[model samples]
Target: MKALSSYLTPVRACGAWLLMTLTGGGAACAQAPQEATQDRMVAKVNGAPILVSDLKQVTDAQTQGIRYQFADDPTKLANEMAAVKLNALDTLIDCQLLADEFYKIGGVMKPEFLEQDLTQIIQMGFRGDREAFMADLAQNGLALEKFRELRERILIMNVMRARIAGTVEVTEESLQEHYEKNLRRWSGPGKVKLHTVTISKKTADARSVADSLHTKLADGGDFEEIARKSSADSHATRGGEWNWLDPTDLTGTVSEVVLATKQGEISEVIEQLDAFIIVRVDDRQEGDPKPFESVKNEVTKSLMDEVSKGRIAERMIHLRAAADIQRMGAD
Candidate 1:
């Protein structure tokens, strides 16, 4: 989103100008300062200085994850980190441009809300002490008025985003198109519903008990009733009802037994280390491709959000074109 390229200014000059413009002039900035680190002016958006420290705050967080990913390749890691820094600075510039645009349009927030937020912060963070708040601001090298101005910038940017999003419109045709485009996502996964009866190995004559139950179930016995009365599994209280689940997640022989069993039919006695079990294949739920009508509201909302995001990006492009953005030492 860089509106224009910029040259690197001497650290002393940059620092001095910042002080002069921002703080109403200070001591002499006649001499070159020490080798600038994070205090270096990395970019400027409409004359607003973007320090390396601001860019670092964003890139450092991203590099933590990226570093681990390219741990063995230092060159790759460095390249990725550099890209992250550049992108972070670009995003910061975008934010500045948006905030400037908001202000240029004479956007104003209610004074009461800003004061209420400041009051809440004071009460909760500083125990309602005005002196403590002032002292904390001073410690951070900030004045009360400057801090309020920064906070208002954040508030204004948020309102600007909301206003841009409000301009987006959604139609039923768009909803249907989006739903069809992502048909696979809207479709349900294949699953099964099951019932079980378990006979614990610790029970005397466990094999006999399992055989009897299996036979009863095969002969049109009430599976729920049999499971409730005989099952030793945790789900025995629920008549051995298992939730609709993907059979692939079931381990070892249980998966085989369930997959082999026909729908609405009972499984044979399955022997396990801890127990003998039988199951009923209550239902096989194959992936059901959803109709557009069934998920119309969800699709509509998703399409609206996507379109709104595109609109915002377009807005940023316009803002950038009208903006004065400069990045130092970037070809």
Candidate 2:
């Protein structure tokens, strides 16, 4: 019976489980009712009553899957479920308002696209098996027509969001600002591609063997072949290739030795408890921010995302302000 605030963002459509007090305490509200059951009103957007059945579909879609996570805490689990249902209810109300505005503003979608989308969903989600998809609906007690209605509404909401996003443009200044602030993301820490050959301490004169391997590597001998024949390390089979590794992941003497080595150069013999290691730096990269012009397109797209989210949120706020939304259970 709680009246939801218009400022709330739309409930995310994923996840599942619930506690909202409503009619038919246990039996009638035990599970989402089948489509044939009489529609019970729970809210009204304008004069169109949002039915309890509609709330149930949203609730079930968002709740039932996560029920087992809170198996040990019944009271907390119920509260969590109620919160999810409440969120879904609010989102339903907002969706109705947005759908009205969308159609009123001449938003149009082709019928064929809807069918194509439904087909894709069934194919991708149910291995192209229509009956399996239908069985899922039957298990949830949902009718196909009703399910289609929800999908259509979701499609309409997407159209509305797209319209708002279309009006958003990323400015040059915004892109530069974003790039400067998130430089760490674009410019990663220094990394190295390395290959190693090792001789275990258990071997006779391990240092001498390590030196011999290092000389072969320095003389353009195949590092992989040398590692496969003589190295005692776990990764010897792969020619001791560690691929690209962050310098931070290397510890103590290993870190010091690798960081000081130049690309295409071999490190001096490093003595460890288990083996004598000789590493070759196949390649290295410095942690420097990429030039602005080099990453301009990517930065622009990221800025557009930020702009679009802001625009959609603002649009929703304006839409809610001009609409009438009523929850049936509010005293």
Candidate 3:
């Protein structure tokens, strides 16, 4: 008999051997409920009933935007369903307890806040068409009024976050350490120094205008003077001077061509967002790790995120302990 490979060997085999150890019996002892109850009491938070219907509604709402496929194996499907129900119940209990704690600490949900949030959500869904957005919400088992109420609950959670997990501070020393450790990842592929003149489509004779500006440049005319007179960019008044920007800062095909060019080279016409841009590279900076001072703010923000996670975890622990919760169903 061949010895099993270390990688191929099972950590814990899910057969009679495993079952006997886990439950002190074999497959016969491991049996599921014959019928799934529709109105099962899953959990209770501070005397509040969390029914199967409630869990299903919350799970359905959460998964509405996600795509799911049931497992081909019946046993696997059953196991997954059990897991989902347990997770949903746990989530509901935590949410309800946290919400109660939030309410106790002078957190009040305002109707005006809900109205603003729901209006934004609906507008985002249907691109500012309120009636079409409301119709979509109705299709998803959400009434405008009910959605507003839910939005208020969400707003209250946000308030809890602000009160419990406040602003995080990151020091310069930490930023320097992070920058040194991840130097290669943060450095860009390349950099460019570009002078630009942009003209919008709304302006009359766009091509002719570009040609006229190009002729002036070719005849040794001042780029700044021409940019001030002919460019339509808001910065045109300041002689079309844009602060040195990374290629990634620009969108679309223009970025591609700009990053590829050598020093002091002019690019052909590049169109973007109903406007044409003429670019000339003043210089190029090869890919190199930026100085720590240059990216200190970015590093600070990253550190703040890590701090926020720990703060939120501690706050949640306190909130859960303080809440008066009762479970209606067995764990």
TM for every model, in the order presented, reads 0.45, 0.51, 0.47
lDDT of 2 by residue, 1-331 (tens): 1111111223322111111122322221112235535676777787666787777766775465445555544434566688876677777776787777765654554457667667766766677888888887776666776766676666566656766667656678888999998886577558899988889989998778888888888898998999899988887999888878897787556776787788888887777656778888888887898888998988887777778878878988888788787788621
Question: For candidate 3, lDDT tens digit of each residue in 1-331?
Answer: 1111111111211111111012322221111122323466766566655566555555555443221333222223344456655676666665565566655554444446445555555555456777776566665665555454444434444455555567666666776776787786567766666677887878898767776777677566787787888888777887766676788777655676687666776666665547777777787766887777777777777667667767867877876787666666643
Q: What's the lDDT of the predicted structure labeled candidate 3?
A: 0.58
Q: After superposition, how far is residue 62 of candidate 3 from its true place, in Å?
A: 2.5
lDDT of model 2 at residue 112? 70
What is the C-alpha RMSD, rounded to one decimal, of candidate 1?
A: 17.3
- Candidate 1 Cα misplacement greater than 4 A, ranges: 1-38, 57-86, 109-112, 118-151, 189-287, 329-331
Q: Compare the candidates by lDDT and give the number of the best one.
A: 2
What lDDT score goes with residue 43 in model 2? 78
lDDT of 3 at 322: 75
Q: List candidate 3 stretches off by more than 4 Å.
A: 1-40, 68-87, 177-297, 327-331
lDDT: which is higher, 2 or 3? 2
Using TM-score, give the best candidate's number: 2
